[model samples]
Target: MTLIDALIQYGLFMAKTLTLVLAIGLLLIVVLRARPGGSGDDDDDGSRLEVVDLNGRYANMADTIKAATLPPKMVKKAFKAERKAEKARAKAEAADKRRLFVIDFHGDLMASEVGALREVISALLIAATPEDEVLLRLDNAGGAVHEHGLAASQLLRLRSAGIPLTIAVDKVAASGGYLMACVANRLLAAPFAVVGSIGVLAEMPNFHRLLQEKGVDFELHTAGEHKRTLTLFGENTDEGRAKLREQLEETHAQFKAFIAAYRPTLDLSKVATGEYWHGEQALSLGLVDAVQTSDDYLLAARAEADLYKVRYRARKRLLQRLLGADGARALARPLARPIGSVARWLRNLGGARCA
Candidate 1:
């Protein structure tokens, strides 16, 4: 080949090689970003614990509005004077002032956030003193017994450690939610918030008759007689129905006992009837200590104590972040199909054991 032609060919080869290299580098970057703890510096458990100074945020909001309303010339002088006053107060009371840590729990049917709650509690158990107070802004309408039971036990850890626990329910804290609330030293709720569904219930549909009409047979084998009580496909006898009721009663008794242990003064018999009430009525029923929103309580508490909002956020896996939680689960359904039936059965069974 001529020198000019050879040079051109070499240049083309170099360009292709550079393009391939760039593509591989970009792929590497994407994969690294998708890894656990890749988005930021997270804990060994692929989580991040954040504590925000709510007092500073509240002060900033007030200062911003105050500055906007004041004349430009006076704005500087007013802020300066406020800063001086704040510095003097901090110096005088910093040593004696107690801290109030706040956290939030927005519950669902599974009480799925309990894992993050455990991490937050673990951190507080080490950092918080008896003088420090904890406020849980809880909004849960209740869920599975075992899941909420675990969540409530995490709160009990604070009480056990001598740290005062206060629960503020601005919306709803019914059934399993109440199970956790009753454990608090003080429970506050919004005026119209729903509360108190201190009861247990289990229900499922039986399709044995439908299968029999279609000339289809479904068989289930269990080692124990009560192991398969209230089957979905198999025929259910009066004995099986009675056994399920007996089990539900047993769970209900345990639930009532748990509340009584934490809140000795509550009249469980009056409230534990599978019914819910609004916040004002809940207070009358002795289910909540006071009818007040979380915001008001935090605002009032900010004046006396330094308030901080603590949160534990688990890093989402790559698929979760890419497709969202539900979509990721859907994508994995085929791989999990082997145990899908059993998982659904257990999930339905758990639905019956709500607080």
Candidate 2:
């Protein structure tokens, strides 16, 4: 070995060692200083209502007033006075004007988006009046039953409060998503938007056959006969299968009853066939009220009234921002459980599927 080569190797080794030591020190400091999740001054105030101004109504109002003709200085004075008076009148009118608040829901199978939904609705219930409207832009394929039921219940709060709630679906609202949408006083969907699939489903794989073939026996014990209707590892019997079907049917009935109660005029027999339809087809079938895109509705509403978006905007933690997503998730994975609770709550709740 050459002397120069050995010296170079030693320097490189020392540099690498120092770099790793510094990294470990930084991580330790971050861990020590880290705050618990959703525990910040901003967390409490994270959610807020923002005014959406797609049109320049507020900005162009001053230039829109008609000024009276007069001599040079008098004309300027009259124009200024007119503008001032107009501003006061506009302000007064706005105070009395009916408001329309907006909230958005982009969901998945687990209906994970319900947590934020509840937060946003709580704020709306405080500010919205009978005359004021709440628009929810929803998109979801659907998921778990009880989870989605809770989500639908959250939207029902607005209905009970006498706030006119409308749901706009640009893409899809099937199964549990429809459960949440059906609570709306009126549903507006884009022409190509997917809707319906009023149904219930559930399924789980069994490894009983694999175990039996391997000469391994599986035994499951439950206090109640129906406590465990199906098993993942144990053998599934016809009785267990029948009991599972019964439970799914009952849940489906509950879903149908809830929807029918809210939308009494709908023909449950024809519409609840577990079949999906495009918005255009759905309108005639009583699945949706109007075939209109959210873009058009919001654009029109913007020109007519003040459009405000109500939301709970949470801020990222200091460590999260500093270390980035991977680091935060890695560190948080163990300390924070129910880790994906909000993510699941954020997903659109869709109806169950059986296989």
Best by lDDT: 1
Angstrom error of the Cα, residue 154, model 2: value is: 1.0
List TM-scores for all candidates, in order: 0.82, 0.73
Clash number for model 1? 0
Provide the global lDDT of candidate 1 against the true structure: 0.87
Question: What TM-score does prediction 2 earn?
Answer: 0.73
Per-residue alpha-carbon lDDT of candidate 2 for residues 224-336, written as tens digits (9 for 90 to 100):
88987778778778998888888888888888999999889899999887889998899999989999998788777764466777777555556667888799778766534
* Candidate 1 similarity to native, TM-score: 0.82
Per-model lDDT: 0.87, 0.78
Q: After superposition, how far is residue 92 of candidate 1 from its true place, in Å?
A: 0.6
- Writing each residue's lDDT as its tens digit, candidate 1 over 103-213 gives 999998778899989999999999999999999999998878889999999999999999999999998898999999999999999989988888998878788999999
**Which one wins on TM-score?**
1
